[model samples]
Target: MADFIPVNEPLLDGNEKKYLNECIDTGWISSEGPFVKKFEAEFAQTVGRKHAITVCNGSVALDAAVVALNIQAGDEVILPTFTIISCGAAIVRAGGIPIVVDCDPVTWNMDVNQIEAKITPKTKAIMVVHIYGLPVDMKPVLEIAKKHGLKIIEDAAEMHGQTYRGQPCGGFGDISTFSFYPNKHVTTGEGGMIVTDDDSLAEKCRSLRNLCFQPQRRFIHEELGWNFRFTNLQAAVGLAQLERLPEFVQRKRKMGAIYTELLSDIPQLELPLVKTDYADNIYWVYGMVLKDEVPFDAAEAMERLRKKSIGTRPFFWGMHEQPVFHKMGLLKDVSCPVSERLSRRGFYIPSGLALTEEQMQQVAMAVKELFN
Candidate 1:
């Protein structure tokens, strides 16, 4: 058997250890350290936001964004069904409804054409998720939001170095969220950030992140909030990772190009699309959708690859198809056919920052062997 290749791995060869050591030496490990402030500032500047608030994790970042925006019970948020459950759950938890739609079969991002049709009088926001490595076509989303007076919450968690139309993805929306999980372009062990230009919203996020404690008296509180504060230790790692983002993005694109070059001839597979108008697909994980000629779904394909000592991951199941959501009577009749189909047909191969050209070629060969 060949060496077992992992699905994703973090690249921590830069100043990760040095910054961590600094945090330990300075005894500034928690949320209230210099690195936290520095990280937030740098991240805010990186994404072109005026404010950046660090949180415990990506889900909490979404939660904080929605809460800070005051999305309430009677409000509705339009989003892509083919994204992580956290996007929908964040809206649901904030007393807002999540109205999901299908994806563009090519980009695998939100189908902008369907968004306008889903908007209702109760619709208060549009949550645009930059799925995988590709940013959503935000032009139409922005137009619809402007026409309908709806807020835009961009989820750029999977699109750290990706840009859309000469602008960074996170800068496009009213409030944007990012994740720094180990699999991301930049990892902080486990952390996230909420970025926005609105001064009031930034202050609201700060209060919400720290349990809504009064500034003068820490214990005194008016409304409820979570202890979603991110640690300085994590911020130190994030700062180091942020510095190397350009290098990371370049590597991912190169890896993507290599995968496309190696596997483009495979008739059974549909590789991630390359679109240069907005931004090139960074190929976050080099996802592939099987063509109809393929006999099996992504699950079976992944299983076969696993047997070949190659790891893979399936695409997100639409929120409408979620058993928990279905049981709760949510999206009962919603049928995002594209999303549903992609869920079954799509899976990603190894495209991590740490992946070498040899490893990529190995993955490509394994995939080709399976297809043949």
Candidate 2:
């Protein structure tokens, strides 16, 4: 039997062990340690932000960002239909409605052309999620935001080292967020960050992550805040990962090139987009959308690959199609055909930093065998 190629595995052969061991030896394993501050500072500098607030996870980072911006009821946040439910949930939890929009069929990102059509008096923000590895056409998104006086929330979770028009991905938004899950370019086991240049927003996120208590007196609270604090242990791992980010990004791009080279000619598959005028695809995970002429959708295709000991993951099911939201009578009339089709047909192969050339060959061979 062939060894199973898992979809993701982190490359932790760097200073991870050294930093973790240091944390253990010093007994500074919690949130109150130097590594947390160091990680925050270093990451802020990397992303070209004045402040980067560490959080327990990416979901909380979005939640905190929405709250920090004071997005209230009657405000609408325009976001892609093809995104994790966390994006919509954050807006909803902040008492704002999420206005779903279709993605560009080719890029699989929120369509900038559709953005203006969705705008209304109630629209307050546009949430641009850099899907897979490609940055959204931010030049136009920024233009639209400016024209309508709308805030831009950039979810750079999947785009750690990616840039838009030479500027880092996280630098474009009023507030941006990142995840350090093992699958991400940067891994802390589990951690997240929110970055912004706005000083007041930065302090509010800091206070919100720790539970809105006045710093002078720990027990006293003026506002409700969740315990979304990041531990020093996680930060230590993140710092080690951050130190080697450029190398990781190069590895990701190389993996993308290998996959595209091997599988580009397969007739039944549509590979991840490669380049745009703004930026090149970083290929965070090598996703492919099965062409309609193919006999199987992503679920069926994934099962076939699994039988051959190849692991894969399906694309995000759009928020508008989510049962929870549908049951709540939200987005009842929303129909994003492109997003729905992508959700059903698209999935990613093994594109982890730890993935080897041989493993990618096996994966490409497996996919070709199935398609052929």
lDDT of each: 0.91, 0.93
Per-prediction TM-score, please?
0.99, 0.99
The alpha-carbon lDDT assigned to residue 369 of candidate 2 equals 91
What is the Cα-based TM-score of model 1?
A: 0.99
For model 2, how does the per-residue alpha-carbon lDDT over 37-85 read when each residue is reduced to its tens digit? 9999999999999999999999889999999888998799999999999
| Structure candidate 1, residue pairs in collision | none
lDDT minimum window of 10 residues, candidate 2: 326-335
Candidate 1 runs further than 4 Å off:
none
